[model samples]
Target: MLSKRSVAASVLCALLATGATACNGDKGGPAAASAPASARPSASPVPTLAVDTLTADQISEQAHAAMAALASVKVDGELTMDGSKLAVHLTSDKQGNCSGTVASPEVGQFELRHSGSKTWLRADETTWKKAVAKEPGATAQDAAIAAELFKGRFITGGDTRAELAEAAMMCNLIKGLFADDSDKGKEKIAKGSAGTTNGVKTFGLTVTTGDGENLTLHVATEGKPYLIRMEQTQGSEPAAFDFSEFDKPFTVQEPAADQVVDFSVFEKKVKKA
Candidate 1:
């Protein structure tokens, strides 16, 4: 039998897991039995989920379907690639619209926004200085001038620069993030026990990849059974990502004309230097 303290701790964990209120805080009692029927609180109807009875692979497929059905999603996580660490907080849609900040040790941090064929990039003085200094035959004077010219302004342009194109690809949540991993041809899928992610009750589906990496996907237990979080262990470094704001409406507004500079001008300046 669990002690009172243990029971209270479990209740607290459930209530605070998702950072949302999970219980009414009313202690169990018999007083409601004497109250009128109308005075009693209506019980919440239990949600019926088709994936509950399915195999682990089937549940993963359902979770992927739910994620694919969303119009947009917010992804926040850090990943390591080739020994370099990258952090990103992005909101992307299937229509190629995205707005987010990506940071890394090499390139510092930058804010990006994309809509249609236009893209806008903003960075601090140090980032601009480093970028300009990388150009062939660029001098310190040229780097300083580049930094001053682009400071406190956005570098806006079409999909002409390869670097910009790669950054903009982060907005493809459906193709890039919600991709079907079953085609990898070397993953073993298994069901995990019930758990909670950010306070939302979830059940996990763990996939052991060909490279011996373990990727655990957490699917919400309530409502639509949407994916709540994903955790991947690659060697010794672990990367975890949280998914939220599913199907929420968001607008990616272009920067004001006065606060923008064309990339062509910057490129020309650097080349002439």
Candidate 2:
């Protein structure tokens, strides 16, 4: 027979071995399987975009379209040229017509008219008669030159009658030009709180031309930018043009034969003199 002390020691050892096996089984089963679940990361949230933000391309297109619309509208305004205030007016149907007058301080007054495809100028009755006597079927170029002479200041060199027509086209083209995509070298000039002009909230945008000219545009609440002003420097003198009284109605009429002057006649006379 075994002794009592030995019997007790044997029983204690058996109990300890069973308890260790139970603990190991619990860890290897459910506890081990759940370790990865606790270590894994959660999903991230999505980002939001602002309402007022616009891309550069979008801004350019908006500007261009605004200019185009302005060109399509009837325009009438006053122009101050060389200390003389002149009335400027334009009207366009499906076809187009434009005319204006410049009353100079020193030089006498002159007028310009365009009808259908014809352009004419009346510079006092004497010059008109002289011009008609010289060239009967004179070109639009002749008419523009006569108009410039009547104003006492001529258009710049390389500025032909065709060029003047192009300039007139610009009044309409400005709408589309601003809507074009921005080129690689160009950059946004200004953006922020806009001020009010004539009860209209207006934002200003300034762009530097490739030829180093600085052009400024004023955009209204309707997302259209009108060429309100432009500045250029020649040596020490600075020249500028300001636009106002926009979106008003005005009448543009065609010139009569008696009012038209042929500039070729005046040119030949100047050469002879």
Clashes of each: 4, 7
Error of 1 at 99 (Å): 0.4
User: Would you estimate the TM-scores of all the predictions?
Assistant: 0.76, 0.45
Candidate 2 residue-wise lDDT, 78-186, digit = tens: 3333333333333333234555542323233444444455544444634432332334344444434444454432222122444234323422322323333544366
lDDT of 1 at 103: 64
Compared with the true structure, all predictions reach lDDT values of 0.62, 0.36
Candidate 1 is scored at a TM of 0.76
Best by lDDT: 1
